[model samples]
Target chain A: MNAIGVDVGGTKIAAAVVSPEGEILNEVRYPTQAIPPNRLVRTIADTITEAKGDFEVGGACVAAPGFVSSAENKVIFAPNLHEIEDIRLDRELGSATGLRITVENDANAAAWGEFRFGAGREFDHQVFITLGTGVGGGVITHGVLLRGAQGAGGELGHVTIDPDGPRCGCGNHGCLEALASGTAIGRRAREVANERPRSALGRLAIDRQVLGEDVTRLASEGDEAALQVLDETGRWLGIGLAGFVNVFNPEVVAVGGGAARAGEFILEPARREVHLRARSPSRDLVRIKEATLGPASGVLGAAALARGEDGEYVLGPSKRVT
Target chain B: MNAIGVDVGGTKIAAAVVSPEGEILNEVRYPTQAIPPNRLVRTIADTITEAKGDFEVGGACVAAPGFVSSAENKVIFAPNLHEIEDIRLDRELGSATGLRITVENDANAAAWGEFRFGAGREFDHQVFITLGTGVGGGVITHGVLLRGAQGAGGELGHVTIDPDGPRCGCGNHGCLEALASGTAIGRRAREVANERPRSALGRLAIDRQVLGEDVTRLASEGDEAALQVLDETGRWLGIGLAGFVNVFNPEVVAVGGGAARAGEFILEPARREVHLRARSPSRDLVRIKEATLGPASGVLGAAALARGEDGEYVLGPSKRVT
Candidate 1:
């Protein structure tokens, strides 16, 4: 059996025709129209149609950025994608594509992808963290995704690192997302540049908006201020990861997202901190690794959901079109 | 059937005759002599002998303050009880008292007690933390203690809250135990008192041995320095709890131990921090409650273990007690 996976991001929609063994047979990509909810559903339908040309589609799964209510197949709240609030995305896309559709949060989808075919391949309990614009995570315990009581269990980024630090979008202070997230890193770099005008980072961003990439680039070039900023970000990441380690004690933690691309520069510090910070039993038992799917992780994860391997979508009411 | 429970602490050894329903029929207590390993086992046997006069003891469970090897039923490394390392306590006590004996880590016993008859009665998944001289915890998932691959699953107190704050016994810095445990609070209070010669806490600690009781006493009486110490401790507890919330997402967190007796002074701040710090899903789904058993919690938990209702200590060797 084959399935269609649609990854709905802020900029583009990517669709993949995936097999049971997690192999991708065919794929298609299209710009996600900056339009109304109905149009977005049409775009998803069109992308799925293009990807379904060479294989018989069993079911379609969409990985959306938001608080997805798996029970209702709706996007309850997506701060990054504000235009699709409360949209019955699965239903609308299913109606347009003439197939059954299952919708899930992107982070959950990525976790399933890792568990089934990537770094967490053989592990029954796993956690996946995506360190993109903000940190997002998904948890799997006993081979099942934990979607809490209200489909909001894996909000790992929101766990507080410092109570008096910067305010997060979730109305909290010193959250993992607010401390080590790409956005937070950029903000911190910009603040430091303004405070210390003599630093090289200050010279680079004289007029343009400072980004996390710029901070990483300067840190790589041996700027003490830039190195300090990355080190601080790594420390916060370690703090958040230590918390996750204590609670879940998962066998593996697969790290994805753009910030993680900095590799050992960020992860080495995080690993050291986690070892020093997490409870001994959990810290000693857990394995931390970079995500195998890279930028394609979310799409592969969404594909796994389409294949009915992802726990959330499988445990819910979604049907197969075969 | 009736059973005996022995709670072996650094200062005292408590034993109780417990019914199948987790009720204590008779209780006995004696000071724990800092003697040789064989003598310690003899003292435990003596306590069981004292309890057996009141009931027909079918089995006995002892909650020891260290790691107990499941394969050999031996005490591994009890730093607090250094004289008892590698001793086959269960076998020795069982032979001496003519009853089946089982040994478990004290924190695990407490968690089982809560799960069977205390605050965690209704939840299948729970995490119990006792904030005493050190932080100790036990995990129950699917009505079973989550003993890790190495029989060291729930060491919650050792999770780091601040990587740079203070040195911990486990050679780590800023552990939750080092920040919020009774020992940590007292140490912090003493440090502050030493720094400020005229502080109320300073005057109260004549010998500079600032115990947890003194800090709680002063904080309750509106002492500014003591309140600051408690508030800081609560914040660390909240941070660690928030991490647990994200990882385990247990239905309830039962807080026990000496420091917890401060009630709202400690619990309120921890609760507020959890609400402010944990992921929205965990905060909304999980309940944070103080231990209902109070000081007797350890003994009751130990009794529950003996009764085989706590699930950590079944009667036969085939069951591999958690």
Candidate 2:
């Protein structure tokens, strides 16, 4: 059997028909910005209906942003996707597509994707962290998603790491998201550029805004200032990872999102920090690596999370890949 | 069938035969300080045997302090109880008592106890934190104990709340334990006393050391310095609890151990801080409360964790309390 996964992201709405083995059979994308304001829900439904064209799909799930209530299958607070918030998604999409449709947090779906087929495929305990515009996280412990009482668990980005270090968009000080997200990386790049005006990163900042991508590019090209910015970001990331390692004791911590493209320049420093802070056995057993599925994780993970009408996983039990 | 639970602590070795309904049928205690060298194992076995007292016990579990490996049923490292470290407990204690005996981390056992019969009895997800000489924690999610890959999971105290605030016993700086434990409370009390020499805490510190208990006592007596110390401790505790609330989304966060005896003085400010720092839905849904079981939580939790020859919980699947 197959399932449809809808990634209702800020920039685009993508729906993919996926097989049990995590193979994508069909996919369609629509630019979210191009959708008329009142047509958001209709466009998403149409995209899913198109993606499911000829496939024998079991169910469908939409991976959206913000505070998602999994039980109610509703997006409570999606800052960018306000058009779809506060409505019972399963009912709306079910009526539209004639399929059992559900909603989930985008990061949680990505994490499930990683757990089902990516870096965490071999481990029962996995923590998936995404460093995009903000830090997002999902946790799988003992093979179950950790959705708290209101399905708002696994918000790893907002934890205080360096208590008084920096201010977070969440109105807290020193959150992991404040110091370690892609946004944080861009912010730190600018600060480093200002401090070392003679460096490549500083010179680039003089021309225009230095994004997280430019930092990775310049560091790969051996720019010392850019390398320092990434190293510092990795250190802060490690501080956050060390806590997760201690708490979840996951076997693999899959780091994804745009900033993770920094790769070893960021992960190596983060690993060093985990070794210094996390306890024995847990610190020794964990493997902190980049997420394998890339941008497609959202759709792939959502498909895996998709359930049949009888309330079972569309992919069934996860099997170990030799 | 009834099961026995042994609590091996720095101060005493106590064992109890507990019924399925969480009733203690028989109990025996031995002062650990009075045990002759190397007789620690013999004394512990004797305590369990004495506590059994002809009860129809199916199995027993020893709730020990240290890094307990649940897989091999071994105590890898016990800082305070070195005599029992690096030994297979199930085999040794099983042979000693002719019953299936297992080993578990003390705090994890306490959390289980709270989950089964105390503050968290009605909740499926609970985070139990003990603030003693140091901080210890255990978590239960979806009615299962969160023992990491090596039974070293649920180490909630080591998370960094204030990255540069203070040094921790684990050699990390600004861990939750470093800022919120009884030792941390005493340290803060001394600092506060020095800063306010006219207060009761300062006057008492001039004659003798002010313990966490003394601060509690003085605060209840309406002393300004003592109240300030507890308020500050609660705030740091809240900082750590806020992260747990976000990450675990537990229905209840139970505060236990000697430091928790301060009650509302330490808990009120912590609640205020949690309200300010934690995100909505999760923060709004969580209840931070004092643990009800007290010292008995150790033994009771161990009893609940006791596994039969079939490797099943002695209490069976949890049932809701009316």
Which candidate should be chosen as best, given TM-score against the real structure? Answer: 2
Looking at model 1 chain B, which ten-residue stretch has the lowest summed lDDT?
Answer: B313-322
Q: Cα lDDT of model 2 overall? A: 0.91
lDDT of 1 at A271: 88
- Candidate 2 all-Cα RMSD: 2.2
Q: Which stretches of candidate 2 lie over 4 Å from their true place?
A: A318-322, B319-322
Candidate 1, B1-322: lDDT as tens digits: 7767788888898998877677889988888765555487787788889877957767777888766654456677776776667878766876898877777778888887787778887776677999887898987754556554344557787765665668987677777888889999989898878766577887876666888999989888988888888888887898888877765667889999999977778888888888877765568788888878765666666665653434344322211111
List clashing residue pairs in candidate 2: none
| Residue pairs in clash, model 1 | none
Looking at model 1, give its docking quality level: acceptable
